[model samples]
Target: MDTTQTGLPVRRGPRPRATTTNPHVQLDQNAPAELQDRLRDHALSLPGVRRGVSTVSVPGTVAFFLDTPTERPAVPDILGGEWGHIHPHTDGSLHLHVPSTLADDLIAAGWAEYHSLVSRGILPPIVIMLYGPRDEAELAVCSSIVEEAYLAAGGSRVDRAGRTLGLPTP
Candidate 1:
């Protein structure tokens, strides 16, 4: 055993563990429906995307689940090549988790277009989650868009297979 000058044991092994949880995993309730519409349009415009679904929880939180006809897209350089695997659920839904910050950037850039769609009442509430930095500001902006859509749609929520969109039940 190694003893320090202060009579404390100095045993070295693996480093202390760090928590992997992210405290910033929150959404803003003020996102306009137009933003979500734009996100859906952008996703659909992608080469492989087949369909998109947006879910809005009360008090404002959006989650988007995009259904792509092909496998997950190759890692983009902007995301430091952080790869995401394609997860195929039993219900025929495919999930691809990418950097959240990247998702936010994409939404912010196309927000105006999305807002236009919302004005038409053709979009639904949904949050987009990707793989990257946890940018609270971006998420908040996106969330506001989703929140607006949900409210505009008469506050109606949808149920997908076993998943509920907008305000989970107690």
Candidate 2:
């Protein structure tokens, strides 16, 4: 294993594909442009949020940073992930960490469902997903739900400097 200066092992091998079962199925990318733009802008606008490489079952995937600027964000225990993220998929669905109540609410409302990874425990149970919205109204609601994930991760402008400086924030 290749170790970093911090002595943490770096992941270097055949990368795992975020998508497989649906590899043959293509999601509508031409649509949801507006929703994607909104998510990108909102996530980037955060004080310390930075876009990371893809880690999900879609194209144009990006992770939202939280808690530790140098390390990836972990889902708050309340959200059921020891460490997790806000993963937005190109298909307009999000593989993000969220609380059970929120997940249940969305699922009951038919707004979201669990990602396959969540089932195998490869991802936290909170990694709920919502398929691409069919209209602007649904898109708007989806955007807000993603924002809730960021908040649950303790992502906030006030905590930016603290995380970046290696000081406790949450």
Q: Give one digit per residue, the lDDT tens place, for model 2 in 1-170.
A: 34334332223333222343533122443235676667566555555456665443345465665534333343544323222233344454556566776666666555556766567666566767654444566555555566556665665524343532211222
Q: Model 2: what TM-score?
A: 0.59
Candidate 2, residue 74: how far the Cα is off, in Å: 9.2
Top candidate when judged by lDDT against the true structure: 2
Return the TM-score for each candidate structure.
Answer: 0.24, 0.59
Q: What is the C-alpha lDDT of each candidate?
A: 0.28, 0.50
lDDT of 1: 0.28
Q: For candidate 2, which ten residues in a row score worst on lDDT?
A: 161-170
